[model samples]
Target: MRKAMIVWGGWPGHDPDLCASMIRGWLKAEGFEVRIETTTAAFADPAIFDLSLIIPIYTMSKIEKAEALNLCAAVSSGVGLAGHHGGMCDAFRDSVDYQFLCGGQWVAHPGNIIDYRVDLTRPDDPIMKGLKSFEHRSEQYYMHVDPANEVLATTTFTGEHAPWIEGVVMPVVWKKRYGTGRVFYSSLGHRAYELDVPEIRTLMTRGMLWAARE
Candidate 1:
């Protein structure tokens, strides 16, 4: 069976545990042998490299230098990495290696919990196939993204909350490569319930499968 690991914990504001449970259920349904861990120590385990995928639900936490390097090496060696929102991007504020693996870092959410639109830039991509640009109500993330990312979706800031960024477009969803591994991220799902949104649900599930080593 394909193996996957979810290491969840950090700021409770993101409901990390709840989100981790939801993802676990989804992976189980997909026939994956999923493992769960609550600490960054899980990243340092050499066995991590054996997994087919890793889903991090940790947000705004610290990771030891050795742990971060092992995690990055696993992905670079072909263990897929997939996550959403702060769980992935906003995680490890002190680890540039982690941020680089994720392809972006959460810099700001200008109008925390506001209505916005997500525009599809690569509708033909497998992860986005048949999906349409839709209206969303949540934290519209303004991230510091990697230029090498294959941007899949984006949102434009109206500057109502942070006027300095008015009209700036930010990547909402993207896929990129970290060595031989596929990395996927989406800046949606501020709340656990937000994952239930049809568009987000589709994007996340498809993105996970897309990122998994095949």
Candidate 2:
């Protein structure tokens, strides 16, 4: 079985613990030998780089230089990385290396917890296969993303909440490579329950599997 690890803990608003549990259950069902940790110290383990995949759910937290370097080295060496929302992209804000590895960083969420539509940008991609555009009533993330990301889904700002960005399109889902490793991220899932939406759930699970590089 493929080996995977989920390290979660940080901002309570994001419910990192609950979200980690959900991801752990899903990964187990997918035949992975999954381990769960509630500390960033897990990233310091030299063996972390040996795992098939790593999911970091801690948001707005600090990562030591050693931990950050370990993670970056692991991903660059072909260990896959996957995460959603602020948990991944918004994590370790002080570490530019981490943000670079993620291919994006959460900048702001205008009109927090508002109704929005997610458009499928690359329906032909396996990670987005059979998925259609869907509606979501949650924070529509405005992120600073890497130009090289292979974007798969997007959303347009209505300007109702933030007029300056009216009709501006932002990437909602994207996949990119950190060296030989596959990196997947979705701006959805501001809260655990938001993942209950079928399309959101499917997209995340598939993205995880794809990132595992199995």
Pick the lDDT winner.
Answer: 1
All models: lDDT? 0.94, 0.93
User: In candidate 1, what are the lDDT values of residues 67-183, reduced to their tens digit?
Assistant: 999999999999999999999999999999899899999988876789999999999998999999999999999899999999999999998998888999899999999999999
Please, what is the TM-score per model?
Answer: 0.99, 0.98
Error of 2 at 36 (Å): 0.6
Predicted candidate 2 versus true structure: per-residue lDDT over 80-191, tens digit per residue: 9999999999999999989999999998999898999999999999999999998889899999999999999999999987799998999999999999999999999999
Any runs in candidate 1 off by more than 4 Å, and if so which?
Answer: none
Write down the worst ten-residue block by lDDT for model 2. Answer: 192-201
Listed per candidate, the RMSD to the true structure in angstroms reads 0.7, 0.8
